[model samples]
Target: MYTFVLPESSRLQEVSAEVSLEELQSQPLQEMIDQMFAIARGERGDTEKRVMVGLAAPQVGIQKRIIFVDTGVDIDRKNLGHLEVFINPILLKKSSAVVLGREGCFSVDPCLCGIVPRSEIVVVQALDRNGKSHTREFSGMTARIFQHEIDHLEGIRFPDRVGPDGVLHWVKEDEYPEYRKNWQQWKVLCSWSDWCAMKSGKSSV
Candidate 1:
């Protein structure tokens, strides 16, 4: 199983390098891609299984401009689980319109989530796994996923995109009766200091 490089790790903070067509088609690169897919599918890992929609090379300690995203398209035109692989991807354009949505990361604590602002639409050019170059436009959730993964290549994380007024929430595993009754009222109930303490205790455990 592959271990994800978490936040604060130097590997996760370095910009990734572009790859050549020859390198993309190499055996080792193919195996790395396969392993990434397995981790995304929850087919590998000793921890609790959690399926991921997208993954980047840097998240797994490979400093290469590569990412695979499950576009949620159908297999037989009516199903799901279609994945699009991007190699040496470059963001060409972003729409003026933007949206805010909650996001989580595999390299970050699973309980941590934060609202992030992202372009509503984006155009990206990239080489596919087969080394074919193509440009595509993505919008909505798919666009958000692409932007998030691309940021990883630039050594950026979702938390870094959160605006000054934005807040990061650490959700508790146990159910809270008060929170369940009125979630909106409890949005800021958990303090950042409390989360820090919880995280410190978890690491010791």
Candidate 2:
């Protein structure tokens, strides 16, 4: 079984390879998908309390272009809370309007989060688990989640998308409420590059 790859691990920095149809139909790949779903749902023993909204293959020590996302809403704006798998996903388009929102990653320290600017809407093309091709347009939180996971396939983490003026904030799991109430007052951490260097043992914060 594969384990979650941390930011410090070099595997997280490598671009993931595409999954061929033959490999996709293999038992091991199917089992990995099952494991990913379990981890996303916080069903795994090592999973944290916060269920992951999305995850990529590289995040779990697999260098393949696979991602699972929880599209929290349905077409009618109803809460669906279901997971979908995308293999060899590609971003087809992105809206000109950008929105800044707080984001955290499972591969990184859960307490570390920062504001990330993302397109308000995105068009993505990929194959489903069964090898069916899909080209869907996603918006709002769903779009954000899709973009984040796709970035992972390209070896890009959420912190790498943080703007120059943006700073990552470390909030303790127990003090989330207080942090939310006074987020601006929280201690500012280093930039994404600095964090990467520190994690790689190239430098300190």
Considering every candidate listed, which one attains the maximal TM-score? 2
lDDT of each: 0.72, 0.78
What would you estimate as the lDDT of candidate 2?
Answer: 0.78
- Candidate 1 colliding pairs: 74-79
CA shift of 90, model 1, Å: 1.2
lDDT of 1 by residue, 104-137 (tens): 6776666566677899999999998889999999
User: Which lDDT tens digits does candidate 2 get at residues 1-205?
Assistant: 6678756786787899999999988898888899888776663232223346688989988899999887774422234477889999998999999997767787777678777899999999999888889999999888999999999988888888885577788767776556555666677565667667745757633
> How many clashes does each candidate structure show, in the order listed?
1, 0
Error of 2 at 178 (Å): 4.2
Give the clashing pairs for model 2.
none
TM-score of 2: 0.85
Please give the distance, in angstroms, between residue 5's alpha carbon in candidate 1 and its true position after superposition: 1.4
TM-scores of all candidate predictions against the true structure: 0.79, 0.85
- What TM-score, to 2 decimals, does candidate 1 have? 0.79
